[model samples]
Target: MVNRFKDPSAHLEIADLFAEHDRSSLPIELGVSRRTLFRYRDLYVHLIETDEELMPNLNAARQDPHFQKINERLGHLLDRYDSKWTEMEDSRAEAFYDWVPEHRR
Candidate 1:
């Protein structure tokens, strides 16, 4: 899936809002419950932290039976929320750019 938003920053905002789960006082209504969001978030964190190779090669991982379930779940959520995993990844890179020293950026 591809992010259709015109503004580049919208990617990060969408990712943040979609991943917010139950943390926000002002909640956004989405297709999935907060519990589902939290569960998927935890899974995403664990997957990225533990699988270094997978992060750089999600397309390949998506084809493997071991990772197919995650890919399907992510695709389902992305479809429901109108997002792409690549957009979430782009948001991570954007955040990293902000985290580094000003000179580095």
Candidate 2:
């Protein structure tokens, strides 16, 4: 029975359907026992988490085009700010060194 659902999408769809329907009637509709349905659901979630092909689909937020654009823009902004931060730190260090007395050095 498990072998029949080799495709990750099928596994996910059936599992989601079972989740939405009454647990007692699920076996009647799916032609499998409740325990088997639970097992399949667990298997499907595991595949979604670990399988390379299905893993990307699990991240709903990252799948959004708007979110992707925002993420890219934020990355660029961080890169620009990081360079300025590094320059500021370097200048502060130089100023600290110059302020130190020769005797203290």
Candidate 3:
């Protein structure tokens, strides 16, 4: 069983697993007990990567009044840096011109 809309070859990992199980388990195909298919779900990656910085970024976005005030101050500081960017841009004019054209797109 595959979804009508999705390409099986494009989803090679999932398609291969289903095909392996179907060949071994389908009553009409193999006439035997079917093994359950599973995804290689490494759920620990996000849990493992959580750190001191993640909490601060999330806390800022959560927008509690105190955090929101800090977020506003950070935004103001960023705007100040942006305002002073012309001098920095002049210092790195060639690199900045080349880099920013790609980024702005």
State the lDDT of candidate 3 residue by residue for 4-100, as single tens digits.
1122233344444345434532223222233332222221011112223333444343444444444344333222212344321222212233244
Ranking by lDDT: 1, 2, 3
Candidate 1 runs further than 4 Å off:
1-47, 50-54, 78-93, 97-105
- For candidate 1, the C-alpha RMSD (Å) to the true structure equals 12.9
lDDT per model vs. reference: 0.35, 0.35, 0.31
Clash-forming residue pairs, model 1: none
Collision pairs in model 2: none
**Superposed model 2: Cα runs more than 4 Å off:** 23-33, 38-105
> For candidate 2, which ten residues in a row score worst on lDDT?
42-51
Give the root-mean-square deviation of each candidate in angstroms.
12.9, 24.8, 24.2
- Measured against the true structure, the TM-scores of the candidates, in listed sequence, are 0.28, 0.21, 0.21
lDDT of 2 by residue, 37-63 (tens): 323422322111111332234244455
In terms of TM-score, how similar is model 3 to the real structure?
Answer: 0.21
Q: Let me know the TM-score candidate 1 reaches against the reference structure.
A: 0.28
